[model samples]
Each structure stands twice: as C-alpha cells, then as structure tokens.
Target chain A: MKHVILGNGPTGVVAAETIRKMRPHDAIAVVGDEHERPYSRMAIPYLLEGKIAESGTLLRHDRNHWIDNRIELVEARASSIDADAKSVTLSNGEVLPYDRLLLATGSRPVRPPIPGMHLPEVVSCWTLQDARAILDRLRPGAKVLQMGAGFIGCIIMEAIANAVGKTGGSLTVVEMGDRMVPRMMTPKASALIRSWSEKSGVEVLTSTRVTAIEANVPHAGLLSLVYKAKNTKERVQVTFGDGSTRLFDFVICATGVAPAIDYLRGSGVEIGKLGGIVVDDHMRTTAPDVFAAGDCTESVDFSTGELMVNAIQPNAADQALVAGANMAGGAARTRGGLRMNVLETFGLISTSYGQWWGAEGGDHVEVVDEAAHSYIRLEFQDDRIIGATVVGRTHHIGALRGLIQTGAKLGADWKARLQADPNKFMDAYLATALSLA
Target chain B: MMNSLHIDASKCTGCLQCEMACSYENHGVFATSKSRIKVFDFHSTGRKVPYTCTQCAEAWCMHACPVGAIHEDKALGAKVVNETTCVGCKVCTIACPFGTINYVADTGKVQKCDLCAGKPACAEACPTGAITFVDASWTGLDRMRAWAEKLDTNAPTA
Candidate 1:
C-alpha cells in the first residue's frame, strides 16, 4: 500500500507516523510547502519571544527523524488531487500515486481588503518568514501597532509585549469587536483581560478598526523637511475608522485565518459552510479513500450536534489518529470535536470548554470576584454541565473539563449546591464520577 | 513484562511521602509542589486520592506534542519529557485529560511521571501501600483476588 499525506503540519506528521507504525511495509510520503523542517505553528509565539530558537519549533527535534521512521518527506505544494485516478499532482509537475490520501493542509491568515495592506511594514504573524520580518524590525523603543485581539492575536501580543517591555517600547492593540477575544470569552471575562493587558503596559482599543495603512511621509513643510533628515527610518501611518491616525514602526495583522482548501475546489470532497473540508466520525471525506483532519477540516461538534472547525491542536491529534487508523485498513471512530481553549495573556490564565457560551435557554451560574481577578461560570443543561469558563484559577481546573466532557448529571441536590457556590465544581465532579463508578 | 504504577485510593493516608520522594527523585528537591504525582485532599469527603500519569497506550501528551519532546521510554514503558528539546508551549498540559503533566515556571518545561525509569520512587516510598509497582497486565489482580476470597461458593443465598 502507498500513502500520500498533504500539509506536513502536526496532523500530517502524526498521521504519517501512525501509518508507519500500523503498516511498516507500506510506502509513505509527506508533502510540505515550507522551507523549514516540519514545524508547529503553535510554537511560533515562543520563538518570537526568544524563549526558544527556530529549531525548537520543529515538530520532530532530530534532523533524521523522518528518515529514521522510514517516511519520505517531499517538499512541494499540492496543486490538485484526482480522486478518480487515485493520484495527486504537485506544483513541481510530479504525480504521486497513493492507495490512501490525507488532506491536512491547515489554515492561512486572511489578509483583509484594506489599502496598503501589501506594504512591507504590514506583516501577518502567521509563518516563520513573517516572524523573521517582525523580529528584524523590532528594536529598542520601537512603536508597534497590532490589529485584532482574537486568540491568535492575543498570543502574538504577549510575545511582542515581552520583547518591547524590556526596552521601554510601546505596543497598541486594536480590536473591532466590543471586547477583546470576543469569540472565545464572555463580555465580563474579556473586560477583565483588557484591564490586565492595560496594566501590563499594552494599550488596548476595542470597537476600533484600521481603515488604511500608508507609508509615513512627513508633511511637506519646512519643519517636516528638517525632521525627515533626523528620522531616516521608515514608518507607517495607520488610519482608524474614526479618522484617527498613528505612526508605528511595524504593523502586525492577525485579523483571522481560514482553511487552506482552495486547491480542493475541483475535488469531489465536500466543503462546509465555514470553508472547511467536511469529514465524518472516521475522518473520511465525501470522496472515497480520502481523509482530512486539523484546522482545515470540519467535524461534528460534541457539545452541539453541529459541524464546526474546532481548530485546536488536541482535536487535530485526535482526528489524525482516527484517520490514520482507518487509512491503514483498521476501524476507528471519534466521539466528536469538543471546543477547548486555554489562553494566558499577560500572566492571566483563562479557559473555556465545550459550548462555553451556553446552550439556548440553559441555566448558568457565575462566581466573580473582581478585586481578586477571579471568575468562574458554569453553563448547565438540566442537571449536567454542558460548558464552563474560568479565569485566575489553575489548580484542578481540569476538573471542570472532566465534568463537562463526561456530561455527568449532578443530581438535583448537587446542582443546587453548585449553583450557590460555583467553586465547588471539584466536589460535584468527584461526587458524580465516584457515584457512577 | 513491563511494570506499571498501581494506585489504591482507599489505602491512602495523605502523608505526601510519595510526592516528596518523586520531587526529590526528579528535581533533587523536597518540595511537594514540584512532585509529578499529587495526593488530592478531599476535605469535605475525608478521602485522599493519589493520582499521576497512567502512561496511556496512545499517550495524548506524547502525540499532541508538536516538538516530539515527550517520548516513550522503551525499557520502562514510561512517557518521559526531554527538557532540552521542550519549547515550553504547555500544549501537553492541556492535552492530558488526567492533568498529570504540568509546566514548571523555573525551567519552562513540562513534567510528568516517568516511573523513575523502572523502579518508581513513589511506590518505593509509599508507607501504606497506596502506590505500588506491579506487572502491567495484572494491575487489577490484587483487587480481583480480594473479591474472589469474599465469594464463597458454599455460602447460602440470603
């Protein structure tokens, strides 16, 4: 048997190893477009923070890991897939035949349609190359402006803040949403994060949008001509929607990302409404012998019976396991994708699980202590916890996940007790789980 | 046959000897906070449950690691973290459902139970036999045997 995997990210690397372990005699090839060794995008933030070198971002540390595993690494972009012919055509004009195929192309940052977005000063913090460019421009007292405060945006903000904090530089973050990390956090939770960021020396502006970015050319005047000679370094003038402008040495756009499935347009695989490849419990696409996983694929959401792109590394690893097993002529099935997000912004840890926003008409409870910067909210459907959001507490927070994932019924008495004091989640979980056992 | 750490929560005394032993074995420290195995004190229920890495067959932390820093120790059947290769992203801490893997701020690396390569210190240091290193295939043998002794074939049906 021959296997060809696309997009040598975490999903591809894991799937390739799984296949090799299951069927060692089978020929396997992994395709990656990047020049660097197969690396994890999740580690890019650490690299930017100077906590680790570029080699630390690699998915496998050893240089000869692929060779040792007997997996072939092909450096090429997949141009198209011919499902009917059981072959994939590469951009380098090579046709590779495969008995099984996996599409884990992952996601790419979306460049919003704003004027001067292509300027060298404006870079999306997505790839290694982009990290290099941003690092090159960073200096002592360098003023940086970043657009977007979503999950990815906040991660990049932390690295940049740390880099600039030591040198007394300035960092301003703009988010069009009403609150920072609006998608992953509730209003109260996001507000607390904003304050924390502010306290940590990051100027956060919400409900703001950058309208345009233009090369900063000093105003044509005698004083401007004199200032231009002193300031030889090029800067960008950013215009906000409210007609406000600011000059920044570098602009980072982390607006959002979408699945890189454009190459699957002609293929028979189905694409979801959110622009992700659609797959079933087995991680198999609509087309036969084709599988997809990772941020590029949409699977059933365990909390809500809907298909969603839960683009987290854990989900990708789970999906890859099932996909690789089935691809190697074994049977496997996934319960579904569960939404999980744990983020640390400026030393403040926050997390959400399952349908964290709560199901419609569901009962919920909140325990907030604004002074201590601690908050815990539990969303309940009947006697079972369906979702949770917590901040400023890390010890045994995984108990919340245990309660939500098991969908354990807290019983009427326990439910009321928890409603009164949401911090008793550990007790509730232990009671329910222990009783069930 | 490989050996596995078997935990008996019912016999736990909450002395925290296992925790101190684990920390000292791995980090050359006596701090309980740095221990890979933890004893949870249920103040309300008056029960202490000691928990650590189960060393799953398909270890989630090992597979979810983007840097492949977590590897299986073939000799001990333990999942060990290579600190030098770890980038301290803390993804493994999330991937672990048991919450046994933890990040150390001092080193910026995640730590978990590696069964002391083969002879686990927690099992050796346990006072009440709450933790023990036993054959992997028969981790439940003692419990099964205890129950078997209770089922007398000659006992009359009530």
Candidate 2:
C-alpha cells in the first residue's frame, strides 16, 4: 500500500514511522512545507534561548533516519486533495497517488487584526524562520514587547527573558485575560505565575490589549521626516487600547494559534465547530481512506465527552499512533484525548491535567501556600478525581495523573481523607491503585 | 533473551546501595540524588519501595519527546535519552506516569533508567535480592514456582 502523510511535524513523522514499522514494505511519503529538515516546533523556544543549535531541533539526529526506515521525504506544500482519485496535489503541481492519507498539518499562529501588525518588526514565534528573525532583532538592551500570556506566549516569554537577561534588556508581556496562562491555569495559579514573572524582572500587564503599531520616527515634526529617510534603527510605536503608546525594538505576537486547515475547505472531510477536522475514535475522517491527527483534529475530550482540540504533544502522539495503525489496516482506538499541560516559566513549574477547571457539580478541594509558592487543587466527581492543578511540587506528581487516568474510585473514607488533606494523595493513590491492581 | 529488572518490595532493606551503584554507574558519582532509581521511604508504614523506569513497551516519554531525544536501545530493550539532543524541556519528566525520568539540574538534561546497558547496577548491588535482572518473559516464574511448591499435590490429602 502507498501512504501519503502531510505536514512533517511530530504527528506526521510518528505516523509515517508507525506505518513503516507495521507494514515494512509499504511505500510512504511525508510532505513538509518548511525548508529545514523536519524539526519540532516545541524546540524553537530552546533555539531562541541559545540552549541548542538549529540542528539540535531536528526530529531525528541520525542523518539517514528516514531513509533507513524506507520513508520518503517530500519537501512541498500540499495544495489540495482529490479524494475520488486517491491523489494529493502539491503546490509545485506534483500529483501523488496514495492508498492511505493522513492530515497532520498542525497549527499556525493567529495574527490578530491590529493595524501595522504585518510590519517586519513584528513576528510570530512559531516557525524556524520566525525564530531567526526574532533572534536577529534581539540585541543588547533591546526593548521587547510580547503579546499574549497563554501557554505558548509564556514559553516564548521565558526564553526571551533569559536571552535579554544576559544583555540587560527589558521585556513587557501584555495579556487580554485577567491572569497569565488563563486558558490552562486557575485564577490563583495564574496570579502566582504573574507575580513570579514580575519578581524575575519581566513586566507583565494583564487585562491589556495592543490597539495599533506604527513605524516610529525618532522625532515627530520636520526632524521626523529626515529621520524616516535615514531610518537605520527599526522601532515601532504601539498604541494601547487605553489610549497610551509605548516604543519597542520589536513586537512578538503569540496571541494564539488555529489549525492550519484552510486548504481543506473543498475537501470532503468534515470540519468541526472547534475549527479542527472531525475524526472518530479510530481517527478516520469523513473522507474515505483519509485520517487526521495532531493539533488539526478534534477528537473526543475524555473529561467533557465532547469533541475538543487538546493540542498538546502527548495527545498528538497518541492520536498519531491510532491514526497510523488504523491507516495500516490495523485496529487501534484512543480512550479519548486528555488535556495535559506542563509548563516551566522562569524556573517555576506548573501542571494541569484533564478538566483542570472543575467539572459541573464536582466537589473541589484546594491547598495553597502563597509564601512557599506551592498550590494543589483536586476536582472530584462523585468518588473519582476528574481533574487536578498543581504548582511548585514536582516529585511523584505523576501519581495524580495516574489516579486521574485510571479513573479509580477513592470510596467514602479515602475521599473524606483527601478532602481534608490533599497532600496525602500519594498515599491515597498507592492504597487505591494497588487495590485496583 | 531480553532481561528485565524484577523487584520484591518485601525484601527491601532501604540500604540505598542500589541508588549509589546506579549513580556511580551512570554519572561516575556516589550521590543518591543523582541515581536513576529511587527508593521511596514511606515513613508512616515504614515500607521502602524502590521504583524506576519500567521501560514500557509503549513508553510515554519516548513518544512525547518532540525532538526524538528518547529512543529504544535495541540490544538492551531499554529506552535511553540522547543527552546531546535533549533540550531539557522536562516534557518527558511529566509524561512519564511513574515519575521515573528526572531532570538533572547540573546537566540540564533528563535521565532515566537504561538498565546500565543490560548490566543493571541496581540489580547487581542489591544485598537482599530485592532487585534482580532476570529473563523478561519469566520474571514471575520464581514466585510462581514458589507458590506451586506450596500446593503439595503429592501429599494426597487436604
């Protein structure tokens, strides 16, 4: 069988390898739009931080990894898919026939509708090219203005902070939400993160929005015209929604991201309301013989029982496995996508799993120590833990994940004990999980 | 035949020899904090349970690794992290359900049990036989045989 996979991100790479392992002789081709070797976008922050070279971001260190696995790498963007003909047409007009197809075209950064947002001084920290542009602009004492404080935003902020900390630069982060990481963290948790970032010398402004950006001329009147003519130093004057302006060396928009599915408009595959391709438990889309995974697909949410996009790496990998196996004429199913996010911002680690925000009618318990910068909140539904949010502590925390994933019942006595003191979760987990085992 | 590390928690003495041995084998150090395998001291029940990477068939750390830093060692059937490629993002440390993979602050890289490339220093250092490297397929054989011996079918009476 011939398999054609789109988007050489982690999901596509993993699915291609899975197919190769299962059906060794099957012809496989992976299509990537980027110029660089297939690399992980997750490592872009590390690259910006000077933690690793560009080559270190490559998915496989071995030069012949793809060739050794007998998988072909096609460097081209997919234009459209002809489901009836079982063919995919590349932007370069090359047509490839396939017995199976996977759509793992991950996500693209969402560019908000702010005036002058498309200027060269502003870039989204998503791709390798973007990283290079940001790095070039980031000089000693550069004034960096970052938009958004969500998961990706916080990661980029941390990297930029580290980079600028060496040169005595300044970073100002603006978020529209009331707290940082509003989507993934609770209010109290986000407040702690904001304070942590502040303590690290990063100026974080929540509940703020940038209204407009304009190329800044050094002087406003006649001198400004002369300065514009010989504008060697590039800077932008950003207008805030509150009628205030600030000058920045460069602006980074990590506002948000959406699934890169514009090319699939005419395709027979069904796009869900969540703006991702809809797939079943087996990862099969509406189009016959076509599967979708990664950040581009809306799978079942384990907590809410609704189709939602849990666009984290672990979920992407799990979905890719199922898609790859089923595409290779094997049976595989996901237990539904679980929302998991673990982040380290300025050396403070925090994690949230499942429905971090408590479920409807669920009993919730929280233990917070502001001075110690430690907090733990457990959301319980009936006698089972459905979600959890933890900050500061990292040892054996996976037991929280273990209990949630296993969906084990704590019974009455254990439940009351946990409610009283959530720190005893490890003991509770050992007791309950062992009994179940 | 592939070999696996089998643990008998009941026989553990919490001497931490396995931890010291593991750290020395991997890091050329004697620091227990640097060991890949850790012995959890349950102060309440006074039970010490030694736990480390199970080297799962479908390892979460290997899959969750975006840069492909973690790979299966074909010879030892161990999932090992390539430090050169690891960005120290600590994503694998969180993905691991058992919390066996750890981030080393000194190196900024994650470390896990690689079974010492099949030698298994922990198993070799155990004094009470709480840990042992045995055939993967028959890890439960000794216990099974022990229980079978208790049946005493030759007695011919209850």
Candidate 3:
C-alpha cells in the first residue's frame, strides 16, 4: 500500500505513523510546504515568548524519527491532485502516485482585502517563518499592533504582549468584531476577555475595522504606493474606518484562516459551506481512496450533530487516526468533536464548550462577576448541558467538557442546583455521569 | 539519571491520555478522576498544563501527613501514599503548594504521582513528549543546550 499525506502537520504525521504501524511495508510520503522540520503551529506562541526554541516547536526532537519510521518527509507545495489519476502534482514538477491520499493540508491565515496588507512589516502569526519575522521585528517596548482578536489572534496577542512587556514596548489589539472571539464566545464572555486584556495593559479596540495600511515612506501618498514600499523597514501606518491613521513598529494581521485547499479547487472531493473539505465519519472524502482531516476537513460537530470544522489539534489527531486506520484497510470511525475552545489571553482563562452560543429557545443560566472578571453561561437543551462558556475559571473545565460530550442530563434537582450555582459542575457530573456509568 | 518526570508544559495538548493511563495502571480502569496526574486547561490563553506531583526531596505531603501515611521510597524517589494509613484528613492536599495531592472521596485517602514505582505511565502515554521521565538532577539539559546553541550563532547557519 502507498500513502501520500499532505500538510505534514499533527494530522498528517499521525496518519502517516498510524499507516506505518498498521501496514509496516507500506510506502508513506508526508509532504509539507514548510522548509523546516514538521512543527506545531500551536507552539508558535511559546516560541515567540522565548519559552521554547525552534527545535522545541518540532513534532519530534529526534531528526531520525521520520527516516527511522520510513516516512518520507517531502518539502514541497502541493499544486494540484488528479483524483482519477491517483497522483498529486507538486509545484516542483514531481508527480507522486498513491494508493491512498490524505488531504491534511491545513488552513492558511486569511489575508484581509485591506490595502498594503502584503507589506513585510504586516505578517500573520500563523507559521514558523511568521514567528521568526515577528521575533526579529519585536524588541523590548517595540510598538506592536495585532489586527484581530479571534482564538489565534488572542494567542498571538498574548505572546506579543509578553514579549513587548519584557522589552517595555506597547501592545495594541484591534478586532473588527463587536467583541473578542465573536464567533466562538458570547457577548458577555467576549466583553470579559476585552476587559481582562485592558487590565493587562493591552489597548484593545473592538467593533472597529481597518480600512487600509500604508508605509510612512516618501512617495507613499496612497495604499498602492505604500505596498510598493513593501520591502522597506519603514514605519507602517494603519488607517481605520473612521479615517484615523496610527503608526506602529510592526503589524500582525491575524484576521482569520481558511482551509488551504485551492489546489483541491477542481478535485472531485466535496467542499463544505465553510470552504473545508467535507469528510464522512470515517474521514473519507467523496473521492474513493481519498480522505481528509485536520483544519482542511469538515467533520461532524458532535454537539450540534452537524457537519462543521473544529480545527483544533485534538480533533485533528482524532480525524487523522480514523482516516489513517481506514486508509490502511482497518475499520475505524471518528466519534467526531464538539466545538470546544479554551483560551488563555494574558492571565485570564476562558473556555467555550460545545455549542457555546445558546440554541433557539434553549434554557440558559449565567453568573457574572465583572469585578472579579469571572463569568459562566450554561446552555441547556431541557436537562442536558448542551453548551457552556466560562471565563476566569479553570478547575471545572474538564467537567464541563465531560457533561457536554456525554450528553449527561442533569436531573431536575441537579439542574436547579446548577442554575443556582453554575460552579457546581463537578458535583453535577459526580451525581449524573458517574451514577449513569 | 535519577527517576523523575520532567514535564514541559508547553508541549501538552490536554489529551488526558496520561490521566487515563495513570488510572488504568493504578485503578485497573480508564478513569481520569481516578488518575493521579491532572491536566489543567487554562482556557483564555489556550494553555494546557499537565500537572502531577513533583516528588519533593523532603516532600510537603510527607511532612504534612498526620499518620505518616506519605512515605518516601528512596529507590524510586517518590512520595508513595500508604493508602491503608491514610485517613483522608485532606491535610496533605492543602500542604502541597503545587496542588498535585488530592483526596479521593471514594478511597478516603490522598492520591498523588508515585512515579508508577519508577516507570511513570503518564510520561509513556503523553503523545507530545511533553512529559518525560528524565534525570532529576539535570532537567535543565535541554534548555541549557538551547541557549548554548544560541551562543554559537556566529559559528554557522545550516
């Protein structure tokens, strides 16, 4: 058997290892678009914070780990795939044929349509190269501006804030959404995060959009001229929708990320509504002998029981395992993942489990302590905890996930108890889930 | 190498495979609640810290135990809880500053990382090499090597 895994990330690497484990003699090729060893993007912030070296970001510290496993680490951009031909064409003009193909080609940071967005100073904190660029540009007290406050944005924001604080630099975060993490978190939870950021000496601007970014170099009258000075290390200016411009040492554009599937444009594999490769529970795409996982694949949202992309590392591993097993001629099914997000912005911790936003007509219970920066909102579909959003609370996060994932129905009394004190999740779990077990 | 679990919290993914492995090794079933190791997810920043008892040389739990339930195993360098003697007073849980010691309600005894009697299951089960059983004396080897490598930056670029 031959397997060609795209993206060489957590998903692709895990799939390759599993394939090798299942079928030892199988030919495995793990292709990645990066120049360095396969590393985790999740560790980028740690690298930025000077906590871990670049090698620490690597998937495995041992250089021979891949070669020893007989997994070919091919560094090349995947140009396109001929599903009918069962071959993937690389940008380097190499056509690799595979008996089974896994499209783990994860997401690329979404570059907004703002002018002068492609300048060298304006970078997305998504890749290893991006982290290196950021580190190089960042010094103590260096003026840093991050554009976006989503999950990825907040992480980068925290890392940059830490880096800047050490250097006595200023940090500013601009989010176009009405609140931080608008898509994942509720308004109150997002507001709590913004307040937390502000408290941590971060200048957070929400409900604002950047219109254009330009260089303060000579002959840069318009955005195009500023973009023309893209290579210059000149001070950059960001123009807002309100027609006000602000200058920063460097800008990080963490606007968003989308499935990096432009090469799958004409591929027979079905694309989901969110531009992710749609895959079944077995992680198999529409095309036979072809599978998908990680940020690129749209798997089932265990909470909503609908097709959606939960692009977290754990989900990626789960999808990869299932996809690898089935590709290796073993029977396996992905139990799928809930929409779970746990973020630590600066020192404030927040978590959103399952369908954090309440379903229509769903009963919800909330407890807010604005002064202490603590908040909890539990959405119940009748007696079951369908979702929950918690801020500044970390101890019972596992229990919240347990209840949501298990679909544990709180008894009327327990539900009332929870409504009265949302912090009693551990007790609720002990009574409900443990009892049922 | 002195037997000690060198935890690099940065590499944790909150998979809880460690917790399951720990529970399975100790309790004969896969249960995180029964596991000695706990992975705490600090949600706001997306940091998953897998915390376990860092067996102190003069362990706090051992010192705080009323009935001398927490005993130090010299061979393994672990603070093994004598479950038979533990009355679950929950004193050791508070005495331990790291919060690694916990009182199990069912067992009515304190539980903590016993190093699996020298072969910690959590280290073996951690997918990301975040947790590793290493030489207790030189857990800083990796960090030192990192800085040492940086010092020779002008040497060459590969």
Give the interface RMSD values of the models in order.
Answer: 11.7, 12.2, 20.4
Q: Residues A169-217, candidate 3, lDDT per residue (tens digit)?
A: 7888888888889987899988888888888889998889899898766
| lDDT of the candidates, in the order given | 0.83, 0.84, 0.77
Which digits, one per residue and each the tens of the lDDT, describe model 2 over residues B84-155?
889987778766655678777678788999998889999999999989999887565454334322321111
**TM-score between model 2 and native:** 0.92
A95-121 per-residue lDDT for model 1 (tens digits): 999999999999999977999899999
Docking class of 2: acceptable
Model 2 over residues A1-437: C-alpha lDDT tens digits? Answer: 99999999999998998888789899999999989899998898889888899998998889999889998999999999988899999999999899999999999999889899989999998999999999988876778999999998898777787777645488999999888998899998888888888988899998999999998857768977886765445489999989999888889999999999887878888999999999988889999999999999988887888888767887898788888988888778777777888887887888888888998889899998888788889999999998888888666666676677768689998889899998777667765754311
Best by DockQ: 2
Candidate with the greatest lDDT versus the true structure: 2
TM-score of every candidate: 0.93, 0.92, 0.73
Q: In model 1, where do residues sit more than 4 Å from their true spots?
A: A166-168, A219-221, A413-417, A420-430, A434-437, B43-45, B141-158
Give the lDDT ranking, best first. Answer: 2, 1, 3
**Predicted complex 2: DockQ:** 0.24
| Interface RMSD of predicted model 2 | 12.2
Pairs clashing within candidate 2: none
| Docking quality band of candidate 3, CAPRI definitions | incorrect
